[model samples]
Target: MNQRTFRTAAATGCALLVAAVGPACTGTAHAASPVGLATARVADAVRFPWLVGPVVVAHRGASRAAPENTLAAVDAAERQGFKWVENDVQQTRDGKLVVVHDGTLTRTTNVKRVFPQRAPWRVRDFTAAEIARLDAGSWFGKGFARERVPTLREFLRRMDEHDLRLLLEIKNPQLYPGIEARIVKELSAAGWLDRQHVRRRLVVQSFGANSVRTVHGLVPEVRTGFLGNPPLNALPSYARYVDQINPQLSKVDARYVAAVHRLRGAHGHRLDVFAWDVPLQNHLGIASTYGFDGVIV
Candidate 1:
């Protein structure tokens, strides 16, 4: 395999990054399993010349390999030669944007132990400074001990250093009112909303249809995706607001894929579809068979 070199800084105390390259690698700075094979081999695959095959996105920065949403997880994705990554973002109590999955800090961080009284430690129930004190990575392993929940700015900086593309999910917009504005503000301040970046390397997605529509109105140039398998009749309306329709792995087939491709997005491009949380190689074969545009694994 051919190889090259690049370095990306891990958040705060983590080490510098060094990722190897191979034929499967497609970075600029750069630089799933099984039995469903018959479905994957279905005839009349939707082929887009822009991509050789379905784009594979590292979920929460390679969650199985590192504590999710931490800089460590992002680096893990880079090390595995993944160019595109998908991570969730939520706002802190002080309205600071942070890269984390859950609306609460319980699962991925040591919030419970740190603030014993802060039961049901809602992410918005604590300040970023307070949340910063918890160990975000130790739950996954000792080597990752002290990994902290990164502020959105910190996460984006790391991603830029690695020259990676991002599919940033607006985790739970309802929990954080005006979050759409806050998110766009942060991305804009980070230079990610620039035409070049927005056009080539960034996407903002939300499970909430209204939140996604709000995002489209805020910055239509920045392509956005709506997460869900809405009824086929809703396709035209959804296409008006989103560039992609990202549904769960179990919710699609060739007919669905073809339906999405037939429409033009708000951005004037073919609407795309990406399945989320897919597991096993057979599923990947099926994505190929069903002609998905991407998969969040």
Candidate 2:
């Protein structure tokens, strides 16, 4: 929907921040592989209210200003008055979680130059120490020379000090076995999973259904979103799994959106749909008008 039209439509309707994305779903009763989750049903969810106002989350830590996924990026995001900073995490060989977006180090780091022995295709196969040898920030520009791939702990410690909220994304779970569990462990250690008095605000999202399910199964308190394109796979089944569904906005048209808002839950309906990959400002403004809970570029 166009921004002006969306704004007008939003004004005319009782739009909730979180709406479902597709057709009517069976919700909990449809037969499918169980998410194996005990309901950590969100309380006071409707009371919390959809953030209709502009909420600028710096995608990959103010990536436009600083090197992505580095401390510099995060610091820049905080300085820019962005309360929420986004980043992606992957697992290392030793089961430590590290902040990075790409599967390989070739594009973001000078790994090819320093570790000539390592091929670009297989760099993720390296140990954390081996991965550390590459200069992650220099290519972004010399000012970020000290920036390196940060461990999850290091990032969390900095976030704790800054008191910034996080949009933590799990990138490519299938490649790294046990990564989901490791992430849970890390969050638990840092108290991100605590239901009471949450120290570090977080919203965990993943493209992998299994990864999202794993998070729901283990740490139900953390908000979860399943990221994907739509026409979506199943209305009833997928709806049952996530707290909210995040579909690429371009894929779904205006007609599909209203149906998503009607999605229900076990004790009644409790599903919300958010749109993603909103790279353009007009799209962000439009998504806000469309009643999306949050928009990510």
- Candidate 1 residue-wise lDDT, 1-297, digit = tens: 111111111111011111212111211110011212221211012111122246778778856556778897777677666678899999888999889988888987888898999999999889989989999976665657769999999999999988989999998899999999998999989989988789889989999999999999999898899999999998999999899999997888789989999999998999999888564233345576787888887
Q: Supply every candidate's count of residue pairs whose N, Cα or C atoms clash at under 3 angstroms.
A: 9, 5
- The Cα error of candidate 1 at residue 188, in Å, is 1.2
Clashing pairs in 2: 19-273, 20-260, 264-269, 265-268, 265-269
Q: Model 1 — TM-score against the truth?
A: 0.82
User: All candidates' lDDT scores?
Assistant: 0.75, 0.63
Q: Residue 238 error for model 1, in Å?
A: 0.7
For model 2, how does the per-residue alpha-carbon lDDT over 1-297 read when each residue is reduced to its tens digit?
665665555433323322320000111211111121111111101121122354445667756445678887777656645677778999777776889999988878888887777675353577778777767777655656788888888888887777788878999999887788888899888877765424337778889988887877776666676787435446556565566666787766555655566675222445555576564234345665565656664
lDDT (Cα, 0-100) at 14 in candidate 1: 14
Q: By how many angstroms RMSD does model 1 differ from the true structure?
A: 10.8
- True-vs-predicted CA distance for residue 243, candidate 1, Å: 0.5
Candidate 2, superposed: residue stretches over 4 Å from native: 1-55, 121-123, 196-200, 230-233, 264-270
